[model samples]
Each structure stands twice: as C-alpha cells, then as structure tokens.
Target: MDIEKIAKAIEMDAGERLPDIRESLQEMVDGKAASVHTPEQLMLRTTRQKLGLSQSDFARLIRTPVTTLCDWEQGRFNPPGSLMCLVEIADKRPDVLRDVLM
Candidate 1:
C-alpha cells in the first residue's frame, strides 16, 4: 500500500518536535507508561496480569474454558460486552471477586 509514503514519513527528521519521544519510549519499555492506553480498548493480557492470575487460573476464575480465554487474549475473538465487564471488575477490584470465589 503506500510504502514510499510510509518510508518518507518515518525518515522525517526529529527537529526538536516531541523531544520527549525517546524518554517516553524508554519509559514504556520499562513498564512505566501507565497512562498510555485509552478506555476504548481493554487489553486482555493487561487485565489478567492486574488480577495476578495465570491464564489457567483466570479461566477458572471466570468460569470460561481455557481455549475461549486464550482466544480472547490472543484477539482471535473479541469478548462479548458482558464478559468484558466482568474482566474489568476483576481487574479493578480483585477482592470482590475473591470473596465470591471463596
């Protein structure tokens, strides 16, 4: 598709514009960019990590099959809104879920 245009855009000089780009990139590499993502898309892996659970454990916690959880995390299929809401809740308040699980 527009390879030449893309190459040109990438080759453009960084003449003081966005001086923080290098620092920001390094911070992201070091897992310090906490505010990078928007609410429009929730990363399944990130949500799962926030719960401090392994894939198997997370699957069990949500009562979803491991294959389905894997598909959702790999982006093979987007989770339905109801499942998304549960994931978000687990991410934001693991204590609430832990009580229910117990």
Candidate 2:
C-alpha cells in the first residue's frame, strides 16, 4: 500500500488496534471513586496532623473511630457508599466544601 493510504488506514483503525485508551479511561474512573473521602474525613485528615491531635481526638471530631479512619487512609477499605456520595458531591464544589468543612 502507498504510504499515504497506509497512514489513513492506521489513523482510522487506531482505536481498534490500540485499546489502551479505553483502559486508561476506566482507570481514571476507578481512581476518582477511590480518591473520594467525606468532607469530615478530609478535613480531619488534612488538618489534625498539623494541630498535633491524636488519632483518638481526630476520630472524635469526625465522629468516627480511629480504626475506621486508619483503615480509610491505609486503603484497607473505603468509607461507606453514602460517604462516597458526599465525597463526590463535595469534590464537585471544592471551594465551598473546603470552606464549610474546614
């Protein structure tokens, strides 16, 4: 085939020949799901370290147990489905979320 014709064919068939983009999009979706954390979780996790609050204190502020927040941070398991929804909603309006949560 002529070089120009081959180039056109490659361009047209690239998605079929290269499925990596589909996988990349899926990975982004998964990361978004995994990265989410509740406003209370985010606020406590981000600030308590600076304030020198013990995990126990931070847990009380966030109304959760030390073990649960520890597990959330460590990726042992995610917050509950309802908390995920709050996280995602907060993420969409980060400025407002940060101000209110902080």
Candidate 3:
C-alpha cells in the first residue's frame, strides 16, 4: 500500500473534505438529498459492538455459524434479508433478544 498517498488522502479528508461530506450526509438524512448508503450495507462490526458481543457470542446468539458471522463481518458475503432483520433488531432493541433468550 502507498502509505504516503493514504496519509495525504487522510489529511485532505480531515482538513477539507470532511465538512462537505458531513453536510451531504446530513442533507440526505434530512431528506434534502438522496442517501448514499443502503440498509443492506449495515456494517456487522458496528452491530456487534452495539450489542456488546464478541463474534463468537453474537454468532451463537444469532444461531449462525461463527464462520458465517466472520464472513459477514469481513464483507465476504452479505447476510440474507432475514438475518439482516435480526441484526437490525439486535442493534436497535437488544433487550428483545436478551429477553427472548432468557
């Protein structure tokens, strides 16, 4: 990887591009512009962190194989709609899953 190029890009993003990007994303959130992200792009790592679970624990909780969970986290494959729904539910209402599991 070109470390110098990556560093320059990071510097540029922090110094100049971040504000415009943030504004554009805000506009999209406010319905002033179209979204740049899709629901399917919900990152597995973020969801797992929100649920306060490790990959192994989360995979068990979701009743999926750890290998599958790792694949999702690594972006090797996208989870199906049903799994996505479960992930959304776990991210938004973790208590629901916790309650059900008890």
Candidate 4:
C-alpha cells in the first residue's frame, strides 16, 4: 500500500464531502430544510414565548423543572398529554392561566 497516495486520496475525498455537508447545514440555517419539531415541542416553546415568560418562569408556572421544560422544548423528551392540554389552554388563554396561577 502507498501511504502518501492513500493520504492524498483521503484528503481529496474529505474536501469533496465537506461542500455537500456545508450546503445542507446552510439550508437548515436558511430555513429551507428546517428540522421538524413535534407538536408538543412547538407548543412548549410558543406557549412560553406568548406568555412572555422565561424558561424558569414558565417551568414554575407549569409546576415543572426548568431542565425538564428545556428537554420538552428541545424535543429530547415529549411533554405529557396532561401537560399538553394545559399548554393548549395557556396558548389560547394566557390571561386566564396567569389569573388562575396567581
């Protein structure tokens, strides 16, 4: 086996592969190939943003840990059905949720 030729071939292969990988990443960043989030994940993030609450505040309002809330929002874990129902209610009626929590 010729080591110098093998190394050159490997470098050329990597150079060729990088452009496609970079293009795919750029597409994602440009929202042309955005990753799909589950409905629960979308709800978790949107509800908090609509409520104008930070992750910690939203987690407190929902009686959950901040890390768990982050996990749900990031799609590392799904929120429970019960939590989803509450999130829907919150999304539709932010004032009511706040008033009840108060």
Report every candidate's CA lDDT: 0.70, 0.58, 0.72, 0.82
Candidate with maximal TM-score: 4
Candidate 4 clash figure, as a count: 0
The local lDDT score (0 to 100) that residue 14 gets in candidate 3 is 78
Cα displacement (angstroms), candidate 4, residue 88, comes to 0.5
Model 2 per-residue lDDT tens digits across residues 1-63: 254444456657774454354554556556654365655556535555654567786566456
Estimate TM-scores for all models. Answer: 0.60, 0.34, 0.59, 0.66
For model 1, the stretches where C-alpha displacement exceeds 4 angstroms are 1-42
Question: Model 3 over residues 5-87: C-alpha lDDT tens digits?
Answer: 55557668677544355454456567785534444545667888887889899888888899998877766677888988877
Models ranked on TM-score = 4, 1, 3, 2
Instruction: Score residue 18 of candidate 3 by CA lDDT.
Output: 45
TM-score of 3: 0.59
lDDT of 4 by residue, 1-102 (tens): 454455556658877534345555556557695667997898789989998999999999989999999999999888899999889999999889989994
User: Is candidate 2 or 3 superior in lDDT?
Assistant: 3
Candidate 2: residue pairs that collide: none
Off by over 4 Å in 2: 1-44, 80-102
Better of 1 and 4 by TM-score: 4
Poorly placed runs, candidate 4 (over 4 Å) = 1-34
Supply candidate 3's per-residue lDDT for 69.
85
